[model samples]
Target: MSRKHLHVVDSSSFELNIPEAELELMEEMISAYEVRRLGSRNHKQKSVSSDTAVIRSFLTFIQKAPWNATTDDFDAWCYQIGREQKVATNSQRKYQSAVQGFYRYIVDNVKFQAAVLDRYNLRIIQLVTEENKIPHVHERQRTNERPAFTHQDFESFIGAIDVQIVEAYKFNSKEFLALQRDKVMFYSMYVMALRNSECCDLNLSSFRSNPNLPEFGDYGFASVWGKGSKGSGPKQRAVAIDHADLPPLLDWYVNDIRPQYLQKPHCDPNEEAFFLTERGSRMKSGSLNYRFKKILGYAGLSEKGFVPHCLRHTFTTHASSAGMSLEYSKIKLGHEYAATTQTYTHCGDEFVNREAVRYAQSIINRLSDDE
Candidate 1:
């Protein structure tokens, strides 16, 4: 447990005439919570800060300390906060979990719970429960609202990028190299099943030739720092680069366009970033989102509500359609479970029916051959 104090509330907004001992106890509790987060949870600074903020906001809303807060207080605060912030149900769930986790930590720690009881004669109980918490059953599972790009839409999107790259090159535009980079970036996201941050964090050393995939040269697989489960850390994995066009495009960009960017006056000679900007640094996630929208507009699919993550989903759905097994797709996408990968597979009803017919035809042909 740490002695560092947490700013639980603004003194000006909510004044409380409390004894020094009680205030000290509250501060100690917050410090201990932070210690648990840092040591046991392995939470990063952003996660720790966000969790603390949520706890502080909940305490402020309840107008009481953690031990004194009740389910009614939690319910009231949850409702008011959700309405006031205009956050989605998922966001509300996160807020609830943060507070809920704090309660759990205090309740489960026998020494801490005993101290609070001995001094203040009060006990903290878990406020968020299965009944009270906002359900994620429908949101996480079932059909995802974030639709994957249909095959035709993907083609149109890539084709539009191609036209932009060619046009930029022909005019000797300053953005010509950027357009080429964007082509590889976006296509790689789709084919490699990369998250936006993962794609941006890529280094020149990330790609290596898979001995089994020698034809792809050194671009056969991309080793990415993948998104982690919980707040653990970056999960690294090698995604196989199977798409034919992807290897050549990536090779061209790396050997040709990438060097040109590195030669910019302000560029760092030793910069290892695979995706470099004109400013001589790694490409930021925000820039990726902005470029994605621009390309979406060019593809005439801007109104379809597609996002960068949708590219991963598009790959999942498209790969399954192209005969990739569910288990293999899960491995390639670095998903923890096959069930999680299943959620990303959003093959249309038409495709399902087509597959059904094809399967039945295969069975019939086999029976006829036996006869």
Candidate 2:
């Protein structure tokens, strides 16, 4: 018999009942693996705990010890969780990796492998094989693709914000000042093509005047720390404040609205953050996402799957349609590659139709002149 067939037959004949001694060995194996990961890999306790949970789940699903788990069992478990539970592809990969890591730990420790084999008469083998495992990808993956907002949708969204602000002010609602801050926050994200974290991380001194753009005063350009690559730190860039209305609005917020936040109880007078909560702390990314979702629903766009990141995509698309060069857009958005900026630009069908009509009109004019 083939080695694989012999092993499968052996695993089949073993008693299904797991003794207390076997359970202790399994727990010991997991604990040793966790210690190795914590010391050598510097994995966080939460991550280690997650790995342990994944191994236990796989064990429960297979109804066998890790040593007796076959590739078929692993594949069936993957299909059950992936198809039935509808887990995301990235999450599926993470779970697969955790199991693979555990098996690797077993294979490397001969003493542990022998302990399990001698006790249970079953040997641990690599379960995650090339044909069965989900391939690791370096590029970021989005399970749900978020579409960019159309111009009408964006206008309606902004109009909703304005209308709510007016109502809040008229009724003297406690959120009146907060709504104003959110308006500026959303506007800045779109106009500057800023990531939500970058917007939330802004401070009072993040903006400064450009000598060439005298009309903008001190609100000419915003210096922000852009999102970095996997291990690298934040990449700093100066995003030019190009919109005519934004500078004045920013000036108004700085002079009028921001001070109100500072006046709250226990607020630090020396706090340098540009956007502050009613509690006087800097705005968090989660809070910004929650607020954006509320505004999206108010604007009747909640069903459209639009997230705050779509604002950055909207900026790139609108900028491209408005005759901004792709190279400039790349620089403005702090993208390392022009191709990355291209991915963000999702122009609508109207822009394409308009360009086609303009091209045909130019051709007709040329024919008339020739005649």
Using lDDT, give the best candidate's number.
Answer: 1
Candidate 2, run of 10 with poorest lDDT:
2-11
TM-score, prediction 1: 0.73
RMSD of each: 6.3, 10.3
What digit string (tens of lDDT, one per residue) describes model 1 on residues 187-247?
9999998998999999989999989988889899889888776556888998899887789
Off by over 4 Å in 1: 1-32, 49-70, 76-92, 106-125, 136-145, 164-176, 228-235, 334-340, 355-371
**Which window of 10 residues has the lowest lDDT sum in candidate 1?**
1-10
Top-scoring candidate (TM-score): 1
Each prediction's whole-model lDDT (CA): 0.84, 0.83
Model 2: CA > 4 A from native: 1-144, 360-371
lDDT for model 1: 0.84
* TM-score against truth, every candidate: 0.73, 0.63
- Candidate 2 lDDT, 1-371, residue by residue in tens: 42222111122333435667777787788899988877766666777777777787788777777787799999999997778766677778778888988999998899988897787777789998767988855222441355677889999899889999999999999879988998899999999888989998999999999898999999999999986542235789999999989999899999999999989679998899888888788999998998899899889989988989989888988998998999999999888888778878777788999989999999999999999
